[model samples]
Target: MDCLISVDGSVTVSLLKSIFFIINVLFYLNYILKNNIKKMNTEPLNLVNGKIMTLNESFPIVESLTIKNGQYYSLNNPHPNFKTINLNGAFVIPGFIDAHFHIKNLGQRLDMVDLKGTKSAEEIENLIYNKSKTLKSGEWIEGFGWDQNLWNDKNFPSSELLNKTIQNNPVYLTRIDGHSAWINNVAAKVSNFDLSTNIEGGSIVNDCILIDNAMDPIRNSMPKPNKDSTKKWLLSGAQYAAERGITNVHDAWQSPEIIESIIELVQENNFPIKCYGMIGGSFKDFLVDFFAKGQYSGKQYKLRSVKAFIDGALGSRGAALHEPYHDDHCNCGLILISKEEFDELASLCYDNNFQLCTHAIGDRGNSFVLDTYQKYLKAQNDRRWRIEHAQMLTTNDIGRLKECSIIASMQPSHCTSDMKWMKSRIGEHRLHRISRWKTLLDNGIVIAGGSDCPIEEGNPLHEFYAAITRTDHDGFPKGGWQSQEKLSRIEALNLFTKGAAIAEFSENNRGMIEVGYEADLSILSNDIMTIESEKILKTDVIATIVNGNIVYGNKNF
Candidate 1:
């Protein structure tokens, strides 16, 4: 009886093992069958045009697709059956490319306080006063985004008034343009400079408004935030950028430390936004070291460019001009860097496979940059060097830009924002040529758009409105300022998308909704092309996709 029981137990264990094997086999077969059924149901679509245009009525409606190796590997193509995504019944466009962003500065500005909507000088003072009252006495109080134009009286506030209002705290408030700063006496003292100290490329106004180089002391005095804080700030900035449909940015000036931090974030799969960094001349070695490591080959983070300042901005009366400022005759404008210096740098960039992007606002500055590009570009043909800001250009300089093949990294919002005071600064004659997008486009110049964030909010729609309408925030001019210079909806979109992608040497990979391109796209809540120009500002981004993944979206479906 014991032997019989043992035999039965052995048979029971064998049967149980066989049953488990059969179940496993059946599960595997079921999975294969389910996948095959899915493949049969989903159809592959190949997109070629800017939009998902339907040309043939007989073509199968695409239910799913897989873009493999920059080509559509679909049911009809030579790829194995697999699942895919189909963006049906929706317009598709390339993701936005901000070609001239000061992303690092934007990151730093995130941690700083903002006072943009201050209505009057007293209101700005009160803002600092209230914030200072909460902090310990003598501690530095920093704020940004104060536009004098929004005030009851459109004029810069005196630092003396700030000092009187915030007696205990050392206050530093930056103008909306970021070209000027109002520093209290206590803040000046803490910066270790009084009325006597003057730094190069900057000025200290009589009432203690620091401009350009004059900001060095105050900037140096402020302690850099800790690593975690910096990371938090950068993350905040990135998330904000993504939500606005800005998938890629060409950061104008960056240090090695900042690049390291960005790389760390990318390694940890933390950073969602793609960045192309340009290391300034002051941080050239950082870029050199990075390139030496052969790490510049990545698609997300690159450091193969250098940004140099040829002159200051027009708002600050420091833009290098052929003639004196129309409003301030005494100041012909400042030349922060000479042509020879820029030429040498350009040559260095050419030899090292680095592209040079110089800030040239005024016609004089633009001419100088053009000459430098001409000198260096003869030796290296592939170097797509750029002239940052390329704001005001003489007709002669416009021709030179086309000859040199330089990219015009411009901000359309600058045109609308500066139009109010641009004529006053350069006279109507020069103002006519200022921000000449029409001539640039006609002459075949590559115009890449950006917001220069922190200085201007990184809103692509605002840029589009500014480019097409050529109107200020309030919708100035019944028709438009330089109505002839207005870009078509498609042209404006290209400036922020395809043109920007070309500036960063990423045109082949991004900038369109073609099948072979990177799956970087922005979906709008409304059709942009059909929308009224005035209503463009009201339209919002519904979703942003980067690298085949949804990074930002406001809707559920």
Candidate 2:
């Protein structure tokens, strides 16, 4: 009996020993799996055999680079354990960043009737008439990219033309600058637009046109895009940007719904490019909510700025100027926001630690914004308050930009586009102060370049060409309009890279191909740095890399 009891105790000990061994084996296997994943996640990606424009003062250029976990790891270093891509001697620069863009509008424009380059009012009317036929009766017919400046008549088209084309549908079309809209009587009646209504900062230019805040009633009456359409538009716009070698965009204005949609896309890993959003001032309630929520900085999105408009576009003569327009003796343009209101807005942004970007196109508009910004911002503080367009400025006010540490967020294309008739609008006397990129740069005031897409072509190449040449696509005016203001090739590149990055407070991690920076790059078919001015427009985007992954094109690997 004693021998049997001892045998049972031995078997019990053996069973316990077997269980412990199995547990140890399982734990070891789990440990191996986890570690393998960790290593894979941290593994480096090497790029070799390329002309890399680092834009780094220290390195400047490199033949190769290594990326680890989506950040630049090292220059001219290749890891044996990681994957390597040969760029085949392509010219690679920091990925282009559009400092100002309208993502939603760009996307929606893709589906709308494109009236760009329409030479006459008759052409636009025909385009709308054709578009109207596709939709059912009463469906809104929307179009964009129409500029009366491009027309031979060079006058605002009467709504009677649209009325003659399609009376059954409500037609709404926006001017290229987006500061004004031309609507038929049908749309005006639908929006309950009353000509007698007193709009403080807007004007109803006859029955056809509404300028600035005057168009709000019509816009509010329009149906808002639902979630699905919003998502589609955002994705489409982002893809369009990616294709253009743009990896980051500072969306100039965003609604709460659009911002939420962007967040959702980023969370789902559906968004391919990084977006820095500036909440629209129109959304007052959302601004209050966002201030309470503080700023959001994610892998692919950020929201920390608010965009306000002090005036309108110069093309539409809605930009508030100190003196009357040369073309219209009695008109000095409109001020969208009064100085008192602007001051209050500035206080809100300053107190909430949000960046303030104001649209100030004319001299008077710019002065008002500069004064308001000075009241809230201390000298040499890093507020980074920006004057969008900064189109027209007085000589005295130029120094104020430096005093306030303001960023001149100018669109190079605007200069070229407006050169055709800008002199007639403001006269030659004030021309020197318009889009003074070189002067602004010399004064130690940073100038961030952008296309202001949907208003312009939104192509980085176009922006670069326009900046350096100060000419249109055809290279007009021989020596370039405002030749002294033209930026050098490298300087032009910096406007879209370093300048843009600095504006968004991402210079340390982006804008340069330095070690430990984000692996964002734009590979071009030709060396834009050495290419001829006219050929710059012909240059093709070979590949656009964001976070060390190819998002658009795959020429080499």
Candidate 3:
């Protein structure tokens, strides 16, 4: 009886063990199969809101495009079971490229009192007076955006009158064009200048108003923005540009120190714009030292160009004209730097492989720069040097720009803005040949357009409108100023997009919408191609994307 019981218990335990093993294997296999199936059905995490993004070309039908790691690819037809957002058939184009901009300066001026719309000298004084009353006694009163052309007198305000408003503080005010400034006697003394300082290629009027290079001393003496303020300004400028659909900026002049600071901020994820900085003339030594330490590919913030000014602007009567100003006979404009200095700088740039962008506004200045560029190309056999703000050019000087392969970088709004007074300054015959984008294009010269912000606010729409219409914002003259010279919509687009990219020597990577290009694009709320030309300025930006990242957008949709 004992043997029988033992055998029966052992048999029961063995049966239970075999059944448990088989059940465990089945459960494991089922879990594995379910996990594999889930993995197989998973969709790649790539999606964007778009009914059908137009890349400056007509699309036959709606389609989804996938961007992975800054490269664009079309999705398979009748594609995946993944999530998607609808763009509602808005127009998408390459993000705008501002060839000339002052990012740091624009950023720093965000909090400064703006006097751009003040109609008269008295109005500006009154506004400054009220603002000064709040600041502590002795603190500097800094302001900007006063244009003498808008004032009743049409002349720069005297320092004596400016003193009445902010007499306790050392006040400094920049003109709207940034070519001139009004400084109190206190600032002049701090810079160790009275009425006798001989500022080369600049002037200090008897009333203590400084023009062109003369303002440099006082400006350099003023307090600079602290690191935090600098960062705030840069970020603000970037956000502002992005919101307006400007994805990239070619910063005209930046010091190496400022570049280093910006680079640090970018590494820490604080920067807001894709920037390419042209090191300032004053900081060539700093750039050289840094470049010697290491050569950069400009993957973050580019530092590959050197910016030098050959002359001042036309509004200040300092532009280097071939003939004396029609209004101011005593001046033929100012030759800011000597030819020897120019040749030395050119040679240095050629050796260093750094591109040069010289500011040449007056006819004489343009001639000299073009001559210098020709000489440099003959010596070095390279032709990427650009002339910034080719605002005015003599017929003789125009042909040389094409021969030397020098790019004529310009601002369209300047032509319209100066049209009112430019003739008065240069005479109708001399000024009639102004801007001449069509002339340059006809001669096979590449013209790149920009806003030169802080000089003129960096608005690409305003630039495009100016280019196509050649009229004031109000649609004046029933036709346009030099209407014959106006650019077609496509031509204007090329200047702002592809031409600008070519100026920076990055044409292959950006400036168009196509596969294998960086995913930098802008979406517009209105169809620019079909919108009325007069209403183009009213067009709004729906989104701005950079490197496949949605940096800015309206977000309402």
Candidate 4:
């Protein structure tokens, strides 16, 4: 990850940071000189004209953009001699950055059997039944996006029920949150498991469904998606993101092989979007070698951190809560790891100067993680470690985030997805405690927005619509679930731009439309800033520019 020392040479992280800073300053100076077209010295290639929202307070709006060396050289000072393409006053903004997406999962899911919006268990069975006809004996049938909570019965299924439809092959279907899975009897035998067996942080509910670590072994048994397929899926995923005006994505919990492939893609310029990866926990053994290498920053890739899971997601009722679940009163939840284990890992990361991005969801989960963080961090340091999710927090735990300077890498679409059933699972009292975007920002905590794709649609506009409005797909609860906690459109934009850049420790030059900032921008068909909140979702991307190159859109300008 982005550690201090390097295995290659004497190139230190501090030295690299200095180099990047110098590069920013130099580029800014270069842009300013070339942009002074009033003198008319240098000839520029293409000039773009539109209503550009720089997101920089110094200069909020610009009429024209001068391009040189594929960078936003200057604003409003276009050369009279060069071709200036006008957009008929389209709205342009900085390319959106998804702060908590997993590129590998998105690619993997592209090839898997989809179960996203299946209304009931019967629908899921019917979907799997059709796929079973094509599978041979002993072959694994894998599917994703099954939510028991979304079903009519709102209860877990049995292995017998799964066995009835998926008789030919062992079938395993993952829950929407990815924290749980439902399996058939054949898969149970294939997984070498007994229903009576006990696991630490996961469970086999109703003798069929596996939660958290319990699902890992079965998942591992399934053949991995090949590199070619991965590349194909990644290309499609990237195209979708680019079309929606996404410039960069955080590839959370990536494997070493995928990371290497990503590196190759960047080198070959085959990767579609700029990817920032978080090494998965399975590669803990490679931490020393990985950390020694420090940061890998190329045109399309950067691996700067390690990822770990502290507890299960709240959706599967596996989140480690301080109290028992309101729905299942007998069960509190699952704790994926021990306090000592988390502390050991935290210390390892802290000692090696690596960023530890832990996934925490429930109240107890957040508390335990914060305590571990406080133990190692006696004094505040610039260790930009993040709490991925930081979903559920008590009233007292809010300030601890500011004290530790932990970045809240949250997905806005999660709120809209869960709001329909949030109170049913957590009870009314606890409902008032969670996801408080405004409260988090009000207490000096830094927030970055995203769509945890494969779980929720990774559309930037959908997330922005949710963040600013705090409403569901149907625009429920007219005033919003908690209107008091809503963020403004500008604040929501920053969550995907500047706020995201700060979380990634790249705020010096990126996130804003400045002379030094990377010329990664998104142009839209409509002016979202002045439009009504409901109409924000109607805004279409006219073009997407990354590093000043048109990667998506037919609007050649």
Candidate 5:
């Protein structure tokens, strides 16, 4: 009887093991079927007969590429079942990323009177006068992109002309750098701005011009754009960027409302380009709100950085320099934020793991930023804090950039735009310290290039040309201004690709054209790598693809 019972128990154990084995086999089959279904549902995109620049050292270039599931699937191997587009030997490279940009401002500028390319202040007045005829009485007549440096007189325009030109409308024209404003008597009266009022970190150049903090009162008096209008502006800016071959932009500054609008547009598929938003310090509560919410990392939009101003633009003599300006010997430029305030903000950002991007345009401003960064950040930490427009740096402070792991978020076009007056602003002695791209690179500091759009033309091709040549559109100064600082074609390309990616901590996924990276590409009319420098400006964007979908210039595809 005992022997019979033991044999029955062994048989029971064997039966249980057999059942478990069958369950395991079923689960494995189910997993395989699910993966196969997913693959079947995804429609891959393939590009053939193209000169694709991967920008990856491992696999530098390829002829054909495959995109599946919105990521690069293979290089030089077009999938047989995928939808294919014949490029006919088109030149393709990693999508351009504007490391520093102002999207909402760009949109607003589009609607305002375009003061760009106006030869003189009188021309600006004529344009404003024409725009005023269209608007109703007491309506604000806003204009931008006036550069006194470009004028023959090279002197700041007075409100005397605007006051006389337009009586019914209040005129407010912003300087090219957006740091100064030329307001008429009507605007001053409407905003109750007193000419004698002394403002900290700001200057009232005259009764008409207000620089840095001084422009705030007048700006606040103006009517704010409603939520709908803000959304419209954001869309307009994104569309404009797409047309210019920019797939990604590090939106330099944004209010909470603007950020919400961007997120809404992105979710609804209205935004065409990817944005890495920086919370603006101008909004008092942005940091608090941002900290509570933590960082946002959506597929098309990201928010993890804060933008604060250390000083103002060089054009207005508002950039804080170590010494008095060569032209204006009576004054050293203004400091918008104090060291105490900056350090406090830095601490908050450090604790919250938010990248701090400060607009430091002069040696003094850059020195303050670097010193503050050293206090909060460890040496060589991966925290890529940025100095937007590290336009000028003292010789001693150049090496401190690498030690603090700071990225120079420079706008290449700014160099060309400012080159005309750079010598006069800081004098010939400090000329080598301005826009030191090669010097910074040699010291192991990375540069993330951009357009600072609306201020400049905001064209990626223009930026590339400016970076390689260090010259304006007219190509003055013969062999390029500060020729030693000029970057190579590959270096300039990386500024908008790999270097830009590293600035935003997206280097692993977005910058390159390698397999497993996001399929963002810019197809150009000509190969910028091999073409003559001047011809680069003429090169048009054939196609701009984001997430494997053509967003701009799709007719070529």
Candidate 6:
């Protein structure tokens, strides 16, 4: 007999004992693992009597949800750990995320003079004049948010006038779009420039303003905020965003120093909002090796992406268009970087697991970016190569965005803010393709709604209102700018919540409300899904919660 092969007749006593031991250990491990998961499911942190959007296909919406520690724990399961409160039918949904914003710039702008909403050139001059009076000699007066499009005259102001008005100190006022800088003679001289100061991917418009990269001189000349100052500023910005129901943000542009400051925030547990930072494009070549990719979910700050500007903004006439601007016939707009350079950078980013989010705001610029994205990334791969602002696309490139599997990170409020003047820049013929959000969606491109914030109001509600209505604050144009392209309320909601999360690569954990998901939520004044489109604008964010803890609004509830 083959004694060694037959278990009953020839198996050694020691071998049988070892086999039994191994089976028992695996059985015990399986039992413990299942029990641990069951504990996660049953752990209680209750909130009852609510109208929740949920955003999960299975649950869709729920009246109650239970959370524990930092996660949802269970949906519809009675949680006994916390006191239950009746919400009186206040609508709750996944937390709003401004998918593209400058956290540091927002903080810095908080300290600068408010140049927004100025109707005339004289008002800006007077404001600068007043600001200069408070400052000592040789101090720089910095301001932002002035728009020539909103001015009745609609002309870029000359630096000669700006110099004469604020003669005591140097002045630098950035355009509403942040793509152009208006400087006084003092600043111009300090930066060493004149009307003929020519730089590619930017312009020295009227000798007073520096557009795009040309403003580098002024940027280098300015005093940088230290880590302490950055943390303070960022905290203020976080509180501000929390109040607005923004639970998360994509920090679109952070320098190397700024990136370290964020690390400090994470270490101290001081970062208030979920920060998905992009080491800004200018520092890409230098910082790529400095910041290795995807240290995802360090609790709050995750550097999983890179931001690049392909062109300046349309409002600044620097949005690299195929045709010259209707208003400015001679200029074809600015191309910030060559495609050859972008392709190599994108390849490196891809290998490093970083999402390459390129900001392209014109037809030509968007086309160029889409083409380059196609060149490096395969069609079927789940690479979320994004086009920030993707404001304009040619007829041929409409489906190309979907074919390349790109996410359109759009600022919905840009429609309302820019609609009044869009005709003058791109003309009515190209209007259909501008912010063709509906078109993009129909062809299967994910639209990640955002507010380029300091560029527009960071209110998630305002973004929702603009996206669905496609109208400005006063609700002009009767029906909407490109009424055909307007999105539904639920669609808009998903854009800010689910799409935003997906863009940040946190969709599985953060976007939806269900068991096993994090409890990041936004309670609204009314049910946005069923509310009137105009009432959507009136909808207020009642509360915001991040990681099962309330960050804004009533703590008692």
Clashes of each: 2, 0, 0, 0, 0, 0
Prediction 2 global C-alpha lDDT: 0.86
Please list all clashing residue pairs in model 4, or write none if there are none. Answer: none
lDDT for each residue of candidate 5 in 1-557, tens digit (9 for 90 to 100) = 24333544544555455445444433433343344312112368999998998988888889999999879999988889899988898899999999999999999999988888789988988888888889999999998888899899889987689889988888888988999999998998899889789999998976889999999999999998888999999999988999989999999998766876776576556788899989887664546655765676766777789999999888999999999999999888999988889888999899989999999998999998999999987788999999999999887888789888889999888888888888988899989888899888888999999989888877899999998999877888878898999999999999999999999999999889988898888998899999998899889898888888788985665
In candidate 2 the C-alpha lDDT for residue 153 amounts to: 79
Per lDDT, what order, best first? 5, 2, 6, 4, 3, 1
307-341, model 4: which lDDT tens digit per residue? 88888988898888998999989988888988877
Clashing pairs in 5: none
Model 2 TM-score on a 0 to 1 scale: 0.91
Per-candidate Cα lDDT values, in order, are: 0.72, 0.86, 0.75, 0.78, 0.86, 0.80
Give the residue spans of candidate 3 off by over 4 A. Answer: 1-64, 75-83, 291-295, 378-382
- Model 5 is weakest, by summed lDDT over 10 consecutive residues, at 33-42
Q: Who is ahead in TM-score, 1 or 5? A: 5
Worst 10 residues of 1 by lDDT: 36-45
RMSD in angstroms between candidate 2 and the native structure over all alpha carbons? 14.4
Lowest lDDT sum, 10 consecutive residues, model 6, at: 34-43
Q: lDDT tens string, model 1, 251-303?
A: 88875556556655665567777888887776544444534443253545666
Off by more than 4 A, model 1? 1-88, 287-295, 338-340
Quote the lDDT for 516 in model 4. 59
- For model 5, the superposed segments whose C-alpha errors exceed 4 Å read 1-42
lDDT of 2 by residue, 239-338 (tens): 9999999999999998766876776676566777889999998776556666866776655677789999988888889999999999988998999977
